[model samples]
Target: MLIFSVLAAAIAPGVALLAYFYWKDRYDTEPLSMVVKMFLTGVLIVLPIMIVQRGLMIWLGESPFAFSFIVSAGVEEFFKWFVLYHIIYNHTEFDEPYDGIVYATAVSLGFATLENVMYAFGEPATFGTLLVRALLPVSGHALFGVFMGYFMGRAKFQEGRKMRFFLWISFLFPFFWHGLYDFIMQSVPRSWIWLIVPFMFLLWYRGIRYVNRANSVSPFRLLKREEEVKS
Candidate 1:
């Protein structure tokens, strides 16, 4: 029973984050099959990179700060973004700006799910620890994706000199955010722990606004455009 509870807490955040994206993307969402495939791609890509990073760090006698922030966060986020760009950048599914968020969120959640599983396995104090991890760290992954997707979509769809700038920002923003989040949580003293919660909440709040703005288009007009294209 105790173990089962642990697993539930571990799995719930990833599942809930994925569900939230699915719900938000109801109208212009990709098929479940594609979403799953993209997500799996993220997991497969990040896991290996993380493993090798840890190995190299151990060999070099490197500090966790260097490994976690510079190598792990930078490399992992880049690969995840690369996978999303490769798979869906030119696909028909990426019609709107918000589609970037949907796909990126899928990949991030995939990575988060596996990461959570590993953390949960090692964690001894089940309930309280699990709850805090789920709300903050796990959900932080989703918000990171939201930041990535927002800019990538803009870069792909928006047409202007500013679009390139936006694209650059989109790519770098998540990487910075992910790195900082990890760095702060890992390196900061326990006395400053209260700051982490609010910081993550700000990221979440920003993600929500991005999603709302992305989805602010008229469903009727989008349907009409589809019908016209079909005809």
Candidate 2:
């Protein structure tokens, strides 16, 4: 019962967060099965990501920036972006901009959920600790997903130079932010821990914008509006 409770606590935030993004798709939503599959794929990739990060850590030594940027942010974001591009980018279900946010958040929260479970079990375990993880690390991944999905959505729906530009930023934008986020957490002293709150707020602000923007530009939104006018 105790173990079950801990597991639930750890997983709840990820589920709730995925639901939040999924909810934001007011017009057309991705199929539930595919979104869940993306989440599971995110969960499965964690092992390989850990293996790669471990090797990078061993090779790079203790340089905080290298580990945070190259190992943590680079490997993780690339894999997530790779998965998004190769598998879902061209899929028929990914018909609109908002679907990108929904799917990307699904993948990210999947990764965050499994990572959270491991962290919970590894540590001494407390409500406060779990709560902190929910607010920061887990939510951070979801926000990164928002950025990634937003750009990928743009890229999918665009053409020529604009499409290429969005594709590049789809990976780069999240890479930079995720790297910086990891760097701050790893380097900043506990005395300065209060700084993270403001940073998190910034992420939240930008993430919300991404969500709104994606939804606004969704082809389905215009289609829905046109249908309403015809009615």
Candidate 3:
């Protein structure tokens, strides 16, 4: 019973967050098949990320700066971006700007779900730890997903050198945000934990704004005119 409870605690928030992002797809929805496929891919990618992080730590030794930036932010974001760009970006279902947010959130939450489970059950587990992970770290991944998807959305419809630039930005921007989140928490004294609040607020604000902008420019919005002409 306790084991099951711990697993549920790890999983619930990730599901909730995944649902919230999927809800934002008001214009048109990607096929559930692709979404699930992307999600599973996200979960599977966690293994490689762990391996790489461990190897780095072994090579460089376990230190605050490395975990905060390189292993935590750099490795995770790089793989997420790589898989997202390689797999989902070119799919026909990625037909609009908003799809970027939707699919990206799916992938991000998938990763978050497994990550939460590990942290939750890998240790003794406590209400405070679960709550903090739910509200902060899990949600942070979704927010980073918003930023990534926003840029990838822009990149998807881009051409020439513009696409290249936007794609790089899509990856790096989230890497920076993730790094900043970890850096603040790890580097600062525990007494200064309160400092994370303003940063979280800013992240939430930017994520919401990005979602709106992505939705507003959805290529699906233009489908009406294309359909009208076809008729």
Which prediction has the highest lDDT against the true structure? Answer: 2
**Clash totals for all candidate models:** 0, 0, 0
Error of 3 at 180 (Å): 0.7
| Residues 65-126 of candidate 1: C-alpha lDDT, one tens digit per residue | 77656676777788777888789888887887778888898898888878887788975656
Rank all candidate structures by their TM-score, best first, as comma-separated numbers. 2, 3, 1
At residue 181, candidate 3 shows an lDDT of: 93
Off by over 4 Å in 3: 222-231
Candidates in order have lDDT scores of 0.79, 0.92, 0.88
Task: Encode model 3's per-residue lDDT on 101-194: one tens digit a residue.
Answer: 8888878889998999988867888988999898889999988888899999999999989999999999999999999898888888675458
Scored by Cα lDDT, where does model 3 land?
Answer: 0.88
**Candidate 1 vs candidate 2, lDDT winner:** 2
- The deviation in Å at residue 167 for candidate 2 is 0.9
Q: Name the 10 consecutive residues with the lowest summed lDDT in model 3.
A: 186-195
Candidate No. with top TM-score: 2
In model 1, which regions exceed 4 Å deviation? 1-4, 55-65, 159-163, 217-231
